[model samples]
Target: MPTLEPSAPPSTQAAEKASRALTIERLQEQAALARSIADRLPWQLAHFDLDLRCRFGNQAFCDGLRIDPSALEGRPFQDCFPQDALPALLPRFMQALGGEKQLRLTEQSTPGGAHTFTETSFTPDVHDGVVRGVFVETKEVAGRARVDDLAQNKRRFDLMADALQDSCIYFLDPVGRITEWSESAHRLHGFSREQVGNMHLADMAAPRVGEEAEIGIDDTIRLAIDRGQWETRGWLKRAGAEAFWGQTLITALRGDNGELEGLSCITRDMTAMKDLDRVMNDLNAELDRRVTQRVRQHTVPNKDLDIFTHSITHDLRGPVRHINTFAGLIAEELGENASEEIRHFRDAMKRASQRLNAMIENLLTYSRIGRIDLHPERLAMTNVLEGVVSRLRQAAPDRQIQWEIQPDLPMVVADAAMVNDLFTRLLDNAMKFTRKVEPAEIQIGCRTESDGTCLFFIVDNGAGFDVAKASNLFLMFQRQHHSLDFEGYGAGLALCQRIVQRHNGRIWLDSTPGHGCAVYFTLPVETAMAASGLAALGC
Candidate 1:
């Protein structure tokens, strides 16, 4: 091959040389820029290649170790820093290069025998599934104990902030400027931390035109500074979103020096509550305007409906009584001549009529309970329960029943007639269910709660039902037991529930199959005499 010189003119050679110099200059500029950026960082950071040699060291890293950055560069870490930390430090760097993406550790080193704790982050410089080197970001944990406390507190604080989904909490500088923000604040205002910095408190509110609407953030800040706290409720504009009703509270915070440092703001977004109130107001207005008129128009028909039901049932009873009377007369006249089948047919008709009458009576009672207005008065329930037990005893005179009534029961705020009726239905249930149990046991008692309400219970050792089906227990015609096993129309419990609800009370039950059942109910008590009396009765 012939020796070939650059086949370009002198000018061309100079231009090529000039291009190379410019490229090199640009690279130097980039390196300087990078160093400048690294030097401005607060934490000590450095990067190393696969050879464990320093690619770069920031100003903070060099200054912290009292080593020249230039001397540290392009030198193996072990040769650059010949100290005991070499053994502990190299392994962490190796771990990063060996495919461990992030290795965070707090290490203590005694270089020249001075204890220093460093929180080091060994992040692998990953490129396309390959770990090329390690980027080390080390922060000096100035006081390890204090840092620990801060970290723990920060975790707890984050949890609390997350839990407050509707409340936005933030910190404002002493001069009424926003300094810090929480996640809730970001969610509520749609403003990032960077976007809200150094913003005056007054700028947060939107302009409003109304005598009642005062959106002045300055006045709010002034009040907080003077009174150490302030609260206000008003419609607040959300960033990039619709306005919402907000309840905001601001309180002053003091530094360790006992000087005013910052203001803590807690703003609760009450959009749901506001919407509910608006809806309720609209509903009430509609009810007052339109519903009242409807009620007036329906008044005549409603009263006619009540009279129709009462009169029609009464008229039906007259026909039923005639049919029974005629059937009895036929049975007497044909006593010797009547066949067994005719007699059986007549008895069946009688039974059907009786059942129809019972259903009509029960329906009338249920309807009347809803239609009639209640007149509540304070009355001793023990007397009522005693009266109910006496009636139950008369109903089943042959059955030996044991009654355990707790003495000196509390007086309840209820309609006496309605309560007596309620107890009659319940005691009837207890006796009906305990028909099989010899010498059936029933316990009537009361319990006094921390609140003023008194809980009364009627426990019986009887055929109990599955508690899972308790939801249907108070529904009309919803019976848990079979009609064959127990004789009932299934309206007693439903009526009892209605009476309790009319008195603004609650009722529940506890029962297990083949064991026993207990019916519990609550009613408001008027005085200590009633509550204390119930409590004294082992309630």
Candidate 2:
């Protein structure tokens, strides 16, 4: 009977009571875990009720104010913050209470009067889509360490800039306002750093006194930002209304995030060099006039002209070599301490020297081409082409090239070395100009002309120049495109022309801009001397 009564279904109220006790135990455990985590965090954390009374404070938050966590709770916002800071922080807290999150970087003074920077965030505590209170978290940013590092970097930059005698370096804000003027800059421009501070970069431009119109500093800054760098040679204003010819280089400075932060400008006083250049140009023009007159009068023989060419190149080589050597020495002396601007100047010197040296070497080669005697021999055009193409292919293994070479090309009597050089130069030119083309197409073929000459043509889909400029295509130092667009000293085509002429062949080119170029040259099937000699031998 007792067992039957006990089975009277366990009371629903008793089952509910057990479940409620378990839930309360779990909630208390979760609350304790959350509080422990908040205390362990490095950031200061706190919560404020809608009435701006502190409801909760983590260990870090209480430690900052030198108060116990429980003691800090129930305190008003005004009591937690300095009276002066309340004006700035109270509105931000109100914003968060209204469900708007707030973030700010602030510099605050400690009780010891030391200033520190902090990044703080205020988040709205929401429940069922309603704002309940504001939760605040803050972290110190080590402002003192960052300030020291910046000072060190600035000192290093100043030391490097002051070492350059002929160049002045300055820095500009993103908007081209002068921010830091170096000692060298002050000395060169005769303007004190204080005078130049916050001045627009354009203010340094000379008053356009009898000079041609040039790009404004505003345009220069824009171009520098767009292109990473911009350089120009113009007159720059100095103190006392004087101006000096200056070579200016503007390099856009970017942050780690690839954002334009500012610009570094290097201006070299080139007034002396500019005057020297003008005098040299006048002397060169006079020398050319005299040389032309002497040639027309037969006073300067061909052999003498060759000697003069060699002598001039030999004389110029010494100074170019000295420039390179001194620049290298300076770079070695500076070693790792060489700043970016100094390295830039040194590299510029090296590049200019190298280019001039290359021009001289090519000139020597061109002179030798006209003097060398051709040894004519029979050559299979197909075999010559294969060897040339193979070498070119190896040099540019990554290029995707489509070759449309004609099979069984005709044999001709020509100098083996000269023919090889001709193909190498023409093909190399084709590859260079077509560098941007995909699956670059190059065709090589030969056909018998009506005049009984072997007419060979090489074609490529490449960047071609205006046909009108073709007349000077074979002249030394004449180029249809700027060196910046295409790397060349304008010597390759001139050498190719000389090589063809010495072999008694004619070369010409046909081209249109953006289309392509086709080069044509004629060669005799057999040399007249070789044919006559064979006949006399009764072959």
Measured against the true structure, the TM-scores of the candidates, in listed sequence, are 0.42, 0.42
> How well is each residue in 1-539 modelled by candidate 2, as lDDT tens digits?
55553443568778988999999999999989999999999989999998889998889989888898779878998888666555446656766877777665565567996656677778999999999999988887755787455556656876999877989898776668776777899889999865774588888887456663267778889999999999977888889857998988999998677866578999999989989999999999999999778766763476677777778887889998999999999999999999999999999999999999999988888777765666777888999999999999999999899988999888777778988998999999999999887878999999988776788999999988898866888999888888888888999888988877765679899999988899999876763336333223210
- For model 1, give the 10-residue run with minimal summed lDDT: 530-539
- Residue 383 in model 1: shift from native, Å? 2.5
Q: 135-206, model 1: which lDDT tens digit per residue?
A: 988887777687667566666886787568878898776567776677888888888776775677666765
Best by lDDT: 2
Model 1: how far is 330 from its true place, Å? 3.0
Q: Model 2 Cα displacement at 184 (Å)?
A: 99
- The TM-score of candidate 2 is 0.42
